[model samples]
Target chain A: MSEGTVSGAALRILAAGPGVTIQDAGRHGLLRFGVTGAGPMDPLAFALANKVAQVPDGSAALEISMGGVELEAVDAAITLAIAGGNFRVTLDGQAMPSAARLTLEPGSKLSIKAGEEGAWCYLAPCGRIDIPAQLGSLSTHTRSGIGGLQGRALAAGDVLPLAEPKVLPGGAMEIEAPVLKRPGDVIRVLLGPQDDYFNDAEIAAFLNGPWTVSVRSDRMAYFLDGTPLTHAGGFNIVSDGIAHGGIQVPGEGFPVVLMGDRQPTGGYPKIATIIGVDLGRMAQLRPGSVFRFASVSLEEAVAARRAEAAEVVSGWALAPLVRTSLSSEFLLGCRLVDGWVDALAED
Target chain B: MSKPLIEGAIYDAPRFLNSGETALVVEFGRSVEPEISDRVLSLDAAMTALKLPGVRETVPTYRSLMIHYDPLVIDRATLIAQVEEIASRPGTAGGPASRWVLPCCYDPEYGEDVGEIARMTGLSEEKVVSLHSGATFRVYMYGFAPGFCYLGGLPPELAVSRRTRPRPPHPPNMTLIGGGLAIVTTFSMPTGWWLMGRTPERMFSPQREKAFLVAVGDELKFEPVDRDTFLSLDARAAAGEVVARREALS
Candidate 1:
């Protein structure tokens, strides 16, 4: 009810994957009440998707996992931006780039399928989503089932109503696929609030790890598989508050990096925390991919985060999409159709 | 790997652990106790009162306070200094927490693990129920799941290690015990604990004015009820009534 004005635009999920859910900047101030902030897995990618759609920052958007989703514009034409992960997409039989923006004519189908890289994708519309906020967030924490699309994943036939758009006039646009620095690069970490619990050898094993991302990974935590870590001090710690990217090593010794939807508090000792700038890289890692961790100073982590924040707000990544078939000069000169195009017209 | 400067002063004073670049954990102690919980909650209240710029949210747990803030708006050193000063100040009393008397039914049908628990603890079923219901429990904090109330002060006799194999999804609203801790589940979840009884009182209801029924520092005592009375209360609670009764403990 606290959402904005409805312009009657809507989108219906024709098909969806298990992990698909609506997410925003995530619920805040409720962590004390045992609520986790279930924001997008890759905050950088999520923010970029919203920027591409010209929606306000942190607008509610669909988080598509590897299984992908099929949707259709129902009531009226709506502009959408797809970002994060290299997902195969087609708008009504026309193949589109993995990360692209397009106006879906009413009744038109849009399909996004699994791509070769990345584990999560985002689909954002250029309007406010009509779903009511729970505890001041649209981010769906599926474990608790409290926010977004009835606090659950979207299923086939679920309709998403939209409010009036901020900027509706734009043609199809696409961006280059996101590139990773390296296949097995070092992810920076800050050693623990509980590092003392582990002896120097265990800490060395953690930092020197070429750990594999477990198949059991989800929004809650990414379970790493490698040499099991034994606690020097006992496994249990007094249950304490956990933050996103806190790497908690249980008695099993395999570290579990807490994600966006991690529980507010945990009983296991946290060995280290992944730096903010590296979290997106960690999130995009496909299951079975190998990675390592390197320790960094607090100053370095802060500096990296501040720089990344500036880049996100700078609109540096966004550029007008140019179709390969049409020359940039030709496409810029021509005035694309602003309103609905006749389906029967010849190209 | 070289430790951060923050870790150097940790041993000398309160342990302030960095949680990534955005959050810091102000640990008051190494174990769970009323004094530690008191310090954590009081600091949480005092910090919230300050309305410090860039402080996004704070999670006050059993032994530590984790403050989530925007590093872009507030630097780490300044935030840590403010917390240390507030923590050192004397005589910050927490508001009186509410004491709740929630109705629970320990019938073998509803409390599926009651017989097993009695066998494990070397006590009769009636004695197990009496011992559990007799103790006055304190709410340490809510975590692991939404509105899942983690209660402290379970009787030593009732305490047992968590099941080696966690059971598949158990029904919600059960008063469960394990690993020296007690919890009233708000939703159906796979728990490694022993289910002692079922409660008609909902610990969490999204539709309710207050979604979370209990708060940290609140005192709770379970009142035994018969199967028929539990059924009636369950029906009433499902219809949106707050079946649990409470009064401020001044």
Candidate 2:
């Protein structure tokens, strides 16, 4: 944060396609009350978005899923960072690079369109966004409507007020965007809590088959379209608490892989769990996307997520990059109204 | 999961199944029972008392307790070992932590299923409400939705299997008695259960300091209320007025 407090225009959504949400780290320690810990679906990307913009890790960032958003800064100068998916970003008609930081003057128009390769993208600014916290987090559990911008998906006409930008007289910054592996046919999982329900042959079938992500998918769970994972006997277990990524095989024979917005407990037998590191990848793939599940050891799963945190200290960088002004005719529209930053700075 | 010998009904040890790299589900048995719930609660209480690092949170259900932790701080092996050590000791049977008496209005306007239950049992609607409100039921566990409780202790006369066709968009704060089971839904989620009455008390509110009104080990008994009373209390609840009637468990 600089010594100068630049109070300016908040963000207004001229249009929001679908599944746009505000997410941060997460809301933890509330599972006993049946509240699922709502957080960013792509946690690694969420963290990097904060880092790229030089904001706190838990700062609120937009989680836009397979959608487009038209936004404009109401007033003030704010720096921005965008990441995740191979999303197409344009500022007032000029293309913007992914994971690059730049300043947005008042009325600066920014647009994000979902790319073919990914389903979700993140838009982060250098300063923290001001939003009411629910259950200790700003992340929205869309199903439960539990937090973030009134606990619902962002639609047209929603205005988001942000705190002042903390740019240190910087030019431009670039963050190392981890190469998101969108293997059309390979997702690693750790077999689990009810894996005993499946026999050797069933386990083999699960490992061998490629399941297509069904249209019936959301933050709660993903219904995969493939040969159902076999349950040797009754698929019922004594009702128990379920975890994120729990692959529960119900009577229907298909596996319902639970995610961030899942209920606290379930009764179906869970044969496996998708490793945490792979969840971001899983979240980015759209329905009809085919994928295969490969079994990983728990040691392998834990090590992969831990490896990311280990990188946070030195693994991330703030490289020097040049930021360019977009093709902005709106600047003149506002400048004619005598709302230029230069005039304000002189005052 | 292994079954215990009939002669030795008590659990000697819990089978701690790995939910994922970061969680473990400690299963006591294969069925729902008060004692199974007791063991689950006791294990949760004990493990939480230990305050092991990286222990994120827990969700206790009918027969198991799921422990969510940070694998970076505490590996799965060490966490399993810690829980295994705790489970080997004599289990503490936790009693009801608190008691609440909720007012339920079974009038037709509120009791969508009361007539159905009365007709099915050859009893009056009055009898259905009395049977529901007469006995004290313990909260076995909390799940399905935030503050949606799975309660036990419905008498046989009131027993009815859950509806084969689930009703979509069921109202929240409704008291539902089904197949000798009961629950007060906190969210307007779909349910196949038989709804017998409505409660004015909002058990789940996001803005409250403690969002959940009851816990897994709490006990609640329903008292029948007239429609006028129901409306009054409901209005107060809607206005963010204090509603749940609570007392310390003896």
Candidate 3:
């Protein structure tokens, strides 16, 4: 069958989950063609789900927000994984962990209930979800009505194709479980290139003020409500390329944190950008959650990221012996015996 | 051809940030202006044509063109120099220009605020529609929405401010006026522009071989079509039967 031809298998959308859509890495560098990269708000969640399912790094996955999606698997035997936010999951009436791999038979009914905590959840199948790539991405850009399920939210009776399974020798390996905790609303930021556009008082207010995440938040941006920061300069500025996490202060004065699907450029003055490490925390923030910006140096941010990476490498190094029964004394004795055998063989 | 030296034109070297660890933004100006957009697009086309080393992609906007590169392959300064070289080159003096005739329907169902626009412009609803359809417009830029064309010409009588309060939902293919100019949107967007009419034509089609029907510096003329003509044209466009007609600027 041609790509994007929906396999006879159909997944019924029982709840039409809130903010759920198909997402890949995103449509990249197509803004000159007037396209925005609409991808997963939490890249970590999407990546983790793909990893857990043993799928390719950039395969398309269901990005369900605050979960209300209910579906029954159709004509394919598949392994599925869920990651990111904490959401209740049930498979054929049995409860399942949020971030574990599950092998389901064809026609298995899966339901993801409303999430008690966190904002986004990701579901990835072992084989890639067959969706047409537009401008080189399978992600849905709802604002532009392009790519993924007719460029709109998934409705009932929308059938999606799952790629043919190629099982690996060991199936999927389980990683160390993350210690779940409530997300703090404190967002760490670094002063932006245009930080000087605001006065010292405005900057102080921006960092110290309690800003509420407005109800008007979405994949494009999170508009904050708080003390309207007053800048010495006027509202208009030379339009500039906007990076993700760039805090745009529109005429309204409240800052809007541009997210994954943001316009490539903007004319608004930006005060600062929330650091990349803190973006995951920002993604899970619920509307009306109060937040304060804590300024940090770029060096500190880089160090934090490096430390996180080191922890992952170290954890992987210890994975082989995680469930092994050999004690330190037994291992030492085995090593000694091996050394003796080596010397005898040399003789 | 000799390169024209544009005095007082400012240029900046490209810079990188670790937001995605791969994407670098090449900023040109601090504010929004036609000149900045033109310069950015010129550089964008040149760099795209050159296929610079380590550059995966580039996005040109109103002021800056963001170049996404593989950090594993290229360093910051090298990418900046490549973009600067393209920007400094004088190939084409201005941006690309084209002529397109867009069909519009002034039916009240589509133009919900035609009476309001008439009230503001001191013209009858028919006069408002006629004056809008009477002249050709130059495409200033494509912005606010994908494939949406911001046209630069409007008869002075129909040059009206945007609505005092924005409507909840504006239909797609809306011809609007604001800040002494008319705009033809290819996508659905909330706007303060004076709602005059709607077109059945889809300005943006991601599935199409050429996704965007209009581009920057294109000349656009509005052809008055009734409901039947709008439906037929829309169907033809969707069926991929209609070819965009381009006429030389007289």
Candidate 4:
């Protein structure tokens, strides 16, 4: 609806791989209307991609899970940034950089291989993707059949329009990255409203137990296969509002961690909530990956979130660079950012 | 006779159940009942009207209203106190009630489980339909899914337990009876309720100028119709006709 023109550089989806959807910050405050805020599972990575592209905070990005996507650019030149869990990426047979901005030319084929470590990846392009916003959000709620590109994922031959390029001063800037483990193990949590439901022994077991992320996991909830927390009271309670990262203990006792795109309300007793700062780490843990929950006080959770937020805000303060010249060699050299270099050096 | 209001332990300052760094659940009651729902709804209405600073939104359920706020703008203590003050205010009675007529098709084709419901209630299919259409039921809450109305005051003779195993997928607009109550589904949700009939009316429409057809505290009466009438009414509603109307209970 913004006066942005549709560009000729269309993305041709060659593989149309598994569970790739366009996501943004998600629609909020519509739960009373039974609409869940369906967005990227890892908001941290999504925000990081936007910051790298210098796109606005709520700009639409491709949420590609388990990779295996191949797309060819059609016409216009665009700046694209890739972030989130480690993934194998290649552009025209050369290795592409993750967590770095790259200038993509017309007819260039960008291929993302399967993710070896993380569960999700984000692809954000400069200039917001043009799509109809439903209920004040462009993020897709696949269950509710609204938002995104016709409320669905990108399929083969889908031409999504990108806004025209504007010239900005400077070249591509990459930040000094922090060292991250391939698959993060410990997920930090804060005690919840129903923490008293479980006794000292059950609480201790829950914190110390190594829970495998069950295959029944999705954007709605992650079913953890681990120790069954005993409850003196029954599991059934009055149905109540559920928030993202709320650890719900159903009748079976295995905790189910509610996630983005979860139901607006549920009845299961929630024992705890994963801290906001560690939610990204939890989201990246692939199914079958084992994780231990570490309990932290409310104060500690707030402090961790503030520390992360401060880092992101400072990261965005660095200005983004725009490219004027379009030589293939120059673009290739730029694609060899620190992330790609680190991976190659390790190899 | 009205039941006496049982006052629970009152908290001058609202307590927070740490949900996450960004969100917390501000619980009002521990049990689910009409009085609890009333308190929750009152708090919900008061908060919405106030439009507190940094409060993104509040969701009212049977007993609790989850207030989601921007932690950066407002701290937990301020929000809890604001909600507590609103909840403690006198004369914050529950919302008023309204009467509504719901036309339902009782044909076996649409009401797939009518025979099962009749068997469970020990009444004939026609008797079951008549009993369901005979009374004006009070709506207790609107939840479980968008626009799904949970109604009370079903005839005791017609009262029947829900199916032991829930249907994998219950149809939208299915009139279901369970636990001495009846529910009209606004969205597709799995249910153990005995499905007696179906209505073509769109109970929940996010795109509509008025999103929900019925709210809490509304009285609903089911009017049985044949398949032909159901089809015509569906068409009329699709054409933007206001077929749903309210009338005095017969």
Which structure among the candidates has the greatest DockQ?
1
Candidate 2 residue runs with Cα over 4 Å from true position: A1-5, A168-174, A181-184, A316-347, B1-10, B118-127, B156-159, B178-180, B242-244
Error of 4 at B244 (Å): 2.1
TM-score of each: 0.92, 0.89, 0.79, 0.86
Taking the tens digit of each residue's C-alpha lDDT, what string does model 3 give over A48-78?
A: 6776666777789888877468776676445
- Order by DockQ, highest first: 1, 2, 4, 3
Candidate 2 structure quality by residue, lDDT tens digits, B1-250: 4422342254556777878788888877766578878888988999778989999898888778999988999988898888887777877875887888998888888798899989889999888888889978888877777778788888889998778788887777998887567888887888888888999987788767667888888889988889999999999987876576888977
lDDT of each: 0.83, 0.78, 0.68, 0.72
Ranking by lDDT: 1, 2, 4, 3
Candidate 1 DockQ, CA atoms: 0.59
lDDT of 1 by residue, B182-207 (tens): 98888898989999899999988888
Candidate 2 lDDT at B23 equals 87
Chain A TM-score of model 4 comes to 0.86
Q: Compute the lDDT of residue A263 as modeled in candidate 1.
A: 90
- The residue pairs found clashing in candidate 3 are A237-B31, A238-B30, A238-B31, A239-B31, A239-B32
The alpha-carbon lDDT assigned to residue A287 of candidate 1 equals: 92
Worst 10 residues of 3 chain A by lDDT: A315-324
For lDDT, the strongest prediction is 1
The C-alpha interface RMSD of every prediction is 2.9, 2.2, 7.6, 6.5
